[model samples]
Target chain A: MTSLTLNAIVSQMAAIEQFTNNILKILEQDARTTPAQIAVMTGRTEQEVKDQIAALEQKGIIKRYKTVIDWAKAGRERTYAFIDVKVTPSRGVGFDDVAERIYKYPEVQSVYLVSGEYDLRVVVAGTSLKEVSFFVSEKLATIDNVQATITHFVLKRYKEDFEIFEDTSEDRRLSVAP
Target chain B: MKPISHIAKTVPASGIRKFFDIVSQMDDVISLGVGEPDFVTPWRIREACIYSLEKGYTNYTSNYGLLELRKHISTYLNERWGLHYNPENQILVTVGVSEGLDLAMRAILNPGEEVLIPEPSYVSYKPCVLFAGGVPVPLGTTPESGFKVTPEQIAAAVTPRTKALLISYPSNPTGATISREELQAIVDVAREHDLFIISDEIYDRLTYEGHHTAVPELNGAYERTILLNGFSKAYAMTGWRIAYAASTPDVIEAMMKIHQYTMLCAPIMSQMAAIEAIKNCGRECDEMAEEYNRRRRLIVAGLNNIGLDCTIPGGAFYAFPSIKKTGLTSEEFSERLLFEEKVAVVPGNAFGECGEGYIRCSYATGIDQIKIALERMERFVENLGVEGRLKAAGRE
Candidate 1:
């Protein structure tokens, strides 16, 4: 392609990135922000906002809209642990195959192939400590190429999913201030 | 015992004082009263403060605040809006914009000198001027004028005794902001009159419409304008109490003289946090402004839908809606709304005389709370009888 065409493509890409970021940033903060409201806030037409969102959804860039719930506040208890796993890679597959196999279990909330001492970092959730330990020994240890597992159970969650779990900080500002 | 100083006795308590007393006693009140952000200071900025404490930085630096923080603020102002101030002598890190305003007033005003103030504005502007022994001449702004004081009004309000003109864009009570051209005209008037300019831009970052015009950036304004801005509204650091004033070195020195005698220095932890905020929290600040913009749309539309005539505020986090159609005074409307619907909105009269027929509702709270408040306000407005509703419709 000509330099002129490349420059035009680059500028267009930047514009598209900015446009999507404006809409996505708002939705990321509050998923329920309407297109009409987004239009007014972003200086775009409501129809345009709607179309852009639809296109994003179709492209699979925009996924689920979820609520960050504090389950403990709802009188329920869930024990979670971050397990570091040492994996033996198979020929030509590396950690991907083992990670895929480990993530297939229902208890695993998230699986990340991280660097450093651990080959894989898995977040597992269970109703109790014993349940998680049982899964770590029986289900996870039983898998092939799973060399060893080190589990660190979350003690008290102060925050999760960018939401503070137990925020009792009252509004300390004056009721009426300039 | 000495009758408390004549100035202190004469200056009336804040107009919102009555509501403050009453609101404090109420339970489960959905308040849109206070003009502060709902978000806590970003964790990174707060962590910076913690780190400062951990590093044992409890001692005061210079009366002008930490040099590193001042340099960061200087760079931020210049990079953000082309406003430059020397970090050494041209900036004073204040406790908040509140202190900045007070210092600006005291530093510039001579006894009995007049300061032109646009109303309804930030409540502290008039009192600050008065406390500094400057006579405050309020330039009334109306809904027809979009709650903006025109250059013509500022010119008319100016007298021979006028020492300075105080202006705040993206103003509290009304989210009104002045355009660059308009501000230039106001600055021109100030120049023509040989008056100083004190520009309180605490709500500068919260401006929703056009870009904020830093007064000092305008031609002929840099020398005379005392530019006040802070991290309170934008960075959600109100409790942290970090703000600054930028101006000429001479004026800063004079302000520093008073500050040294009284405040000495702003808290070191807050200064450290402010340094972090200015350097690294730009994205967090922008995101908060975006959130405020979304909430601004909701509350403005909600107020209009409830039969209140609300002008679209161009900036800040407030929605100043006319409650005149309800056939009640500003105080009466606010009191009734609070008692009847458990929604707390400041009466416009609390801002100024021109604000008497309106009410100032802050949109800084959560979306769900705003929605609930709007519903309650709708019911309250409906219960005001057919005559009031008819008046509202007639105005429409």
Candidate 2:
């Protein structure tokens, strides 16, 4: 009876692995792959695909779908910069409090507690280099516990999130070929 | 009217062209027809090309391609498959494997000589042989054996005028991979008959179950093998049109002569990019292959679940599901699937006669599209009635 229970547990684990692994992979590759479409791909019924996706969402595993856009190609003029900050860790919370405060601003795209000379690396985006500089000099540098800052404005984006920006090659594949 | 040559006139247009035309006119059709990756070329590789362009690399490379690119390819092949070829004389870059195949056939084949080709394979192989004034002898492989060519089939197909054995493992339509032992058997047969081997390994990097065995790596096979590989499938550099053929010096020189007169060289920008790709893009290629493997599992399971009787392919991104239960030929099934459900998969018969009862669905598209397509196909299959479903399940 114990062995039988173990077998059931093992099979249940296998089922969970199958469901989660397949759904996560599909979603990660293209989050746009809808529940209905995922159902067909994974051999699950539409309802099952929906249930698994909903469960994943409820569990906070499925986050959000993002479009990889080449802003340069779209003729959108924008400035991006990476600001490395030397921060004094708070007594009780260490870098968490400072990192959290820096990330609250709309312009601060991402903040990370990084190693090396700088403690926090904040990535900020703005309409112009001047605006980004202003944000860094005024808001970012003035934040409590921020000791110093180093700003590196991004000159050009060759790539972002696995998408190559300036590729001229057209897809030459035939619609149907052996 | 322009005067078409006799050979050109005799060669039939690709059977898929009409379907492509129809597909082009339709809207909202989810296609699993194309045999190319959905991913673009990795950014670092594209950046290398852009850097090359900025540095003014617009000029044509040598007819044999850049020495740097060749050396990298040589190192890559040696490291990956334990195959060695002199970059100076044994490798010639061509405009993708398409041109390499043509060059190899033209370089070796005499008029009316036969190249034994496994059927339901790449569409280009037979036509390339025909255009080169060589006969293509079809060696039929079946779904029963996972579409792999057997030693018996190869032995039976060999005849007096047979010049070479042309094979593409991790095959396109069927997504079958020939094992190292199986390939060794074929190599033995080739040696017995004293025939050359033309191996297209474009999909070498996409294998899931086992590592691909380059035919030239087999014992007694290296000297007589013309190995064709390209960056198109592996690196998602299809449009860059870079491929190389490695062979004995004599074959390479012969192919180079034709290549010089016809192609001149592969694009210089692409060559520079390829150098970067071979040097730096191993992790990206592995990630893409892993993604494809996941999709492969999903699509295979979905097909089998839908009662299509699909064999789980060992490599390549296609799922060659048998559609025989619909009581329709491959063409009928493909047409109905496209029109009724708005899901387009190539009729398997487009590959060859042996592909009659199946359809080739590529899992290279987004999982969402694959899922949607599967749903539509399942609905279509269910509407075929209980008898059809039973027949597909092999219980009828």
Candidate 3:
């Protein structure tokens, strides 16, 4: 009876692992996979799937759901640039303070501490190239760490967030063929 | 003044079509009925086709397909399954497995020969066999056996007229796959009976529980096997409609004969895309299979929890859940589920008669939609006294 109880516990743990792996994979591919849908796909009750998702969210495993938009295809015009920074570390904070200050800017989309010629890599987006240029010179270069900045303007985006930018091909499948 | 062929008239319209017709009339229906993958073709494969088109590869390919593409396919098959076919004469590129099946049927079948088909499979096998003038002998498999066609079953069903056995593993509707050992047993029977084997391995890459064994890989089965596979399910290239059949020289020549006049070639652009898919998109296929595996686990568990006992399907995206507890036939259950809960699932009988008391729910949709459909189905099942039946069976 004791061995049976232990085996039951082991099986229960395995089931939970299965649920976590399945839920994470679905959410990773398309966060729009609803808790209800996740339930159906996972063969768990909606409540269970929902609870697991909520737990994952609380545990920070699921940061957020995002939509991948082809801005070029959508006819939305935007300017983007990658700005590399050479920042001098503060006495105590190193690059942490400067990185935080740069990331706090609304124009800044992403910031990464790097290991190359530049100390920090910043991705910024704006309405136009002029605006992005202005942001880099006026706001980013003006930060207190106060080092040189090199900005590389993006001419074209071949792919972004796992979606190809240009996909104009029509469906070639026959309507009734198996 | 009408001239529809007798064979065309004899073949019944697919049950899937009827179910979809009803689904189309309804609004906001959460459908688990589509057989294709939810993922679009991987971008690199699509891009390869675009590249090919830009490079002026618009003309038709060789009747046997591009030698380069066939070489890559040969390499892929060899590396993945240890099965080798000479690309020059043993491979025939096709317009998806649909045309491949048709070609295989037409290539081998005499006017009155029969093809033994295991039931609860993809919808095209029976019709393709019939259209080729071969009688389709349905070999029924039961849920208790994981929907596997046992050697005993095949042995019993075989007749002198049975010239070939058509099988799809990691099956479409049932998601049932016979183990390698079990398949060897069946292959042994096929060998003893001197039957040809037409193996549809379109879903080979999608198995979750175990590796899929290509029938031709089994000893003594290669010469008699027509192994059909494609880019559709594996690479989410269904729309591309490029597939191939690998068999012995004589069988391939026979298939190519039908293919040359009828198809000329698989679309050159799609064939180019298939080359890229076969060569570069393996990781993406594995990732997609992993995603499907998760959904498979979820749907199988969800259905069984609701008293609609479902065996954990090892492959494909479908969950064949028995609706026996509700005392409703498969069609009746599908109709009511669509009408009342707005959740669309294909009736199992859409595959064959052995699927009568079951329904095939696809988990290829968004996870949220699957959950909503399951809830709606659970409610629908409870209203039909499924809970009471579960208690009576002492299964809860």
Candidate 4:
């Protein structure tokens, strides 16, 4: 069944039969947190917790789980960069494909299409910008779309992230009654 | 490939840069993206660069930077923000606040430690964190909320792994600022959580509404905070690329080691230019900021008159106006406007997902350019309305 209609969002029938929200939340944070543990915390049966995680995984919300590894100590100097560029013309053509090629360089960390003098500001680093530039000149520039490049090699790094943040009503953290 | 072993293969690129490239090719595009100051580098600052050349100061600075320049930074920070940064060790001169940010990310963030990002923010924060092998958690602050992240918001975003909470006021994209009371409460949360504060006050001097507030102004917050600032926006010297970060001796020592190897030094002449820029920060910063303020009001008022609703940006020279009426996503509106009308604007989604439905219009262009652009925009919108194009184009 596909959700063609918005009303199909939280189906009443789907809400019953072990697809409870509490089990999913528990699984999302710690998929290994036992159904029994979830039952203790969420007041759901162990069977229900197991069923919800299975359902949520099917929904693609509970993607594959992984552990965080500290690789900075594993003999690599992590480098960050912000390279501002002046982009060339890409009218009436598959410009994005060309842009993608330039961005695909192994040295490229990220490529942003920014406003100002630089058309494409890339974020990439290697052992050094020398390594970064080798990829830029040999790989990125050779990608056919890149016109002019100016590298603002990062002399230092301050911050980054990839998690979701939201504002809720009831203040979930405060209402948790910790 | 000099393959960066041990790092995650995937690093996210900012969606905004693509639009910037698109707008660059089109003629007559007046841009408000990029969060750059509209004014040219103050004459004093520019003259300083020329002066440095005349003096032939063309050698690399000491790894930490010119002693005189560091002194000026310490003095500037103390006078402006009432904070003390030891010139000898607590401060390390960087290429720009961009580099200062990178250094901090390198120094403090070990893999898997959480660094909380408050958005819509400068495009750099999240990418920098991820590259450092740290996990980035974003906190969304909306326009309805003046884009200010509250203490409660900070607390909710924290997990046990949360090593740092960020504060960027006179912010980019949103132009939202934090009140002292609100900041103090955030400081309290950091103390409770035992988290560090990464304070980005790059927009510190351009605050039009009132005096700027820093998380470092609070008692314990300064000790636990890494201060990042630069001459880019404030001094209108983005090209010169001189900025620095301030922290305790231990943290700075850690960062300086990374910086020395990463970038042996910022351009020698750029440091010379910064020495002059800092000494003349008083009038040089104010004159350009005042002009930016005038342009800021004009653009905001004009956008509103043209039927694009925009909130008053308290600081920075950008007015982010919602283009929902134009019935275009930030990209569609920006692209068509560039190709058809020749007006350049950055789509809001470039900053974060929340920035969708809006476009960042920089007031950095001349008053005449803004006025003409506004007139063209009014015509564009009116024409779209008459043709029933905007609404029909799937814009609500």
Best by TM-score: 1
Tens digit per residue, CA lDDT, model 4, B279-318: 8667768767756765676677788878999888888777
Model 4: residue B350 alpha-carbon error in angstroms: 0.6
lDDT of 1 by residue, A37-137 (tens): 77765667899999999999999899778787667778778899999999988787678888888889999999998989879999999989999999999
DockQ of every model listed? 0.49, 0.30, 0.20, 0.01
The TM-score of candidate 2 is 0.79
TM-score of each: 0.90, 0.79, 0.81, 0.66
Tens-digit per-residue lDDT, B1-396, candidate 3: 898999998799988887776776777778788788888888898899999999999998899999999999999989988988999999999999999999999999999898999998789899998999999999888888999998998899888899999999999889987799999999999999999999999999889877899999998999999999999999998888899999999999999999998889999999999989988888899878877877677677788889999988888888999998788899888888888888888888888999899988887766567778889999998877965677789998
User: In CAPRI terms, where does candidate 4 land?
Assistant: incorrect
Every candidate's lDDT = 0.89, 0.88, 0.87, 0.75
lDDT of 1 by residue, B1-396 (tens): 558888899889988887988998988999999878988899999999999899999998799999998999999999988988999999999999999999999999899999998999788888898999889999899888888888889878878898999888988888998899988998999999999999988888888787899999999999999999999988999988889999999999999999999999999999999989999998998888877887887788889988898889889899999998778999999998999999999999888888899999998898778889999999998878665666669962
Candidate 2 interface RMSD (Å): 3.8
Report the Cα lDDT for residue B125, model 4. 81
Which scores higher on TM-score, 1 or 4?
Answer: 1
lDDT of 1: 0.89
How well is each residue in B308-373 modelled by candidate 2, as lDDT tens digits? 999988888899999887789999999988998998899888888999999999988866677788
On a 0 to 1 DockQ scale, where is model 2?
A: 0.30
Candidate 2 lDDT score at position B296: 87
TM-score of 4: 0.66
The candidate scoring highest on DockQ is: 1
